[model samples]
Target: MKLSKNFTNPLAANNPVIVQILGICSALAVTVKLEPALVMGLSVTFVTAFSNLIMSLLRNGLPSRIRIIVQLVVIATLVIVVDQFLRAYMYDVSKQLSVYVGLIITNCIVMGRVEAFALGNKPWDSFVDGVANGIGYALILVIVAFFRELFGSGTLFGFDVLARFGYTNNALMLFPPMALIIIGCIIWVHRSINKDLQEK
Candidate 1:
């Protein structure tokens, strides 16, 4: 079904992170720890899904010349709401996330979906596409964060799993470069398995 493809494609076959590589900066920035990555993922999914729905609803009436401006306004409003909620309810995590949470407004994944899919599709379809792409981005962030947090901090979600086994954590895994390396490895493995992605 078309709806199913919109939801499933971004999970693997058409992953925005590994395939399109649209939002790699956030993937690298927030993956040093699992908690932040999880929060970031949820926030992005929420924003993208709602933003797409909003854009799709407005598509017919939106003036072509000011569509980008309107899109930013809608996105900014959602980002602010999410940011404020984080600051109020999850102060410590909000502190850890810092401006990155607010930066969701500018994430290409969000903007791209709004422009490309939402502007031309029905509300339900655009919503599905937004969620799919957000999950695609989030999936990679979580994967990178899992490795980085486990090896880098000797813990999973701060539980100290590696320390239990008497293994030392690798400091390199705490760095941003390591996130990039892990993402690169994921892309390599994905492309290897799905040879259709290989360049002709």
Candidate 2:
């Protein structure tokens, strides 16, 4: 496959979250606010890209039977590094994200791409695939967070908008179920636009 396809496909047609329905845990967990969502998105993106690169480089030497175990070890190490970096530089956000950062090791998007794309592709292509899926995941996160923060608290990244317009915040938006509702809405719209994705 072309490198450009690796880079671009995941942003839409092959999006890890919207299309593939991978990585929904963090997408719903950290997206109650834009800041946390942004941080989580970037963190996942960083981890995915680097881990994909490392895995691609190691692919040839990896034994098929132990590959999954090795992938987990590498992913866990990367997640810890990212968590530590966040604690050092962005303590508050780190605290807010809490266990979610560590949970990246379990994220289906990361493992899925690492195994499905990186193991079989060149390192550069794997990196592009990683970045592409990460961006794809992040795009959904930001969109969900934007709406959640806006309607839930009457703010966008902590700036009041609905309040200024004499509107009351929708308290339901702050809850986890709202995130699913938003995601479902996004899926609905996506499937509507891409008729091929609709159920028969």
Q: lDDT of each prediction vs. the true structure?
A: 0.93, 0.92
What is the per-residue lDDT of model 1 for residues 44-158, given as tens digits with 9 covering 90 to 100?
9999999999999999999999999999999999999999999999998899899899999989999999988999999999999999988888889999999999999999898
Candidate no. 1 TM-score: 0.98
Best by lDDT: 1
Worst 10 residues of 2 by lDDT: 1-10
Which runs in model 1 stand beyond 4 Å of their true positions?
none
**Model 1 Cα shift for residue 149 (angstroms):** 0.2
Model 2, residue pairs in steric clash: none
Measured on C-alpha atoms, candidate 1 has an lDDT of 0.93
Q: TM-score of each candidate? A: 0.98, 0.97
Candidate 2: Cα lDDT at 189: 90
RMSD of 2: 1.1
